[model samples]
Target: MDEYFERRKRMVERLKDELKISEKVAKAMLEVPRHLFVPPHMRREAYNDYPLPIGYGQTISAPHMVAIMCDLLDLKEGERVLEVGTGSGYHAAVVSRIVGEEGLVVTVERIPELAETAKKIYESLCYDNIKVVVGDGSVGYEELAPYDKIYVTASAPKIPVKLLAQLKNGGRMVIPVGDFVQHLYVVDKDEYGRVKKRSWGAVRFVPLIGEEGFED
Candidate 1:
């Protein structure tokens, strides 16, 4: 336990120096025990700054990427967030820490196995503010529409219009768009419901498979 804590501390420090992530994001990342989200065999590498395969061809994003996305969204306490891929649920756990008890994280995953595992992890860690649902994430979880912030962990050929419609006015979404190559984009909806987009930089992510996304 102490070893994992020390590794996590070092990982966060490196992320802060290298990416210049915000204090809030760093704090959230530091508080989440990433090892709990990984497969038992890969727990030793959980804090390393790289993606790791969880299962079903899905991956848990690197810690730096998680920090970058959270910083871009400008997550705040009491704001609800929608995460479009639950993978290992590490990202959601970190976001839950930042959002606090007053806020909520509604994360959607396509695979039931991953969702169940993530749900169990959240319950075990007492991350009660997070809700995991199994569904097609590309269409966005509309049962609770208009979130304060949204993010997609996979790459899409284009910005899924369904997701854009679910962004509350003044909300922000960070997603990666492309086919063979992808770039991270920050999409914001203004108070008047006007949408604007800008690219953050190139990034590679597994393809998002579903309606409004690449066909499986």
Candidate 2:
């Protein structure tokens, strides 16, 4: 356990430097046990800086990418965050820790089996603030409307307008958009219904499949 923590600490340090995130976010990365969210077979590679396959045709986002996106979202304690594509539940777990009990993290996974497994992991880890739903994530979770922050893990051909509607005033959303190649898009909505969009860089992710996402 000591070695595992040490490795994660080092990884977090590297992430802080590489991703240019605050120390608080770096600490969150270190504190969240990535190994617990991964499969036992992949536990040894948990601290690696790259994404790892987590069954169900999904892969956990790389640490650097996660740090970059989280930092870009500018998450704060007690903020309501919506996460599209829970994948292995690693990202949601990280957000759960950062947001703490006062905050709420609603994560949507399109696959039932993956949602079930991730729910078990969240329960075992005692992340009571996170709510996992098994359904099409592109439409956004309506019951938990008006999120302070939104993150779309899967790449889509374009930003989901429905998701934009769910963002509170002055809220931000990070999404990867494209087909063969993707770019990280940061979108911000203001009180007057004006939106600002920016591109971080190129990235590749599994296609976000559903209404408001890819056609196929």
Candidate 3:
């Protein structure tokens, strides 16, 4: 237990020194127990700044990557957030902590097994504010439309309009777009539905598989 706390502290420092991370993101990183999300064998390496495979070819994104994405999303308490992928539920857990009890996080996972596993982890952590669903995340979850922030965890060939449509006015979305390679794009939607897009940098993620993404 104390070891996990130490690892969390180390991770927070890594985010601050290595990346231009926001304070809220750093706080979230420190609060969530990342070791619980990774497999037992990988717990010792959970704090490392690198992506680790969970299972089913999916991976929890690097800690710094998660921080950057969270910072770019600009999450606020009471905001409605949507996560396109729930790999190991680690990213969602971090978001859950930042959003507080008022905010709600709806994460979609295409793999049923992974979704179930994530749900158990969420329950164990008492993250009642986050809802885990099994579906094609590339299509986005329409039932919970007009999200204040949207994060696509996987790499897509293009930004799925369905997700953009789901973003609230003046909302922001951070997604990695590309095929063999990917670049993180920060998209903002204005009140008039005008979208402003900018690329953060190159990134590599598992392919987002679904109707709006790569062919499964």
lDDT per residue for candidate 1 within 58-87, as digits (tens), equals: 999999999999999899999999999899
Clashes of 2: 0
lDDT of 3 by residue, 31-130 (tens): 8889898899999999998999999999989998999899989899999999999989999999988899999999999999999999998998899999
TM-score, prediction 1: 0.98
Q: Please tell me which predicted candidate would have the highest TM-score against the true structure.
A: 1
TM-score of each: 0.98, 0.96, 0.98
lDDT of 2 by residue, 123-188 (tens): 987889999998889999999898999999999889999999999999999999999989999999
Off by over 4 Å in 2: none
Order the numbered candidates by TM-score, best leading: 1, 3, 2
**Which pairs in model 1 have colliding backbones?**
none
Error of 3 at 176 (Å): 0.4
TM-score computed on alpha carbons, candidate 2: 0.96
Candidate 3 ranges with C-alpha deviation above 4 Å? none
How would you order the candidates by lDDT, starting with the best? 1, 3, 2
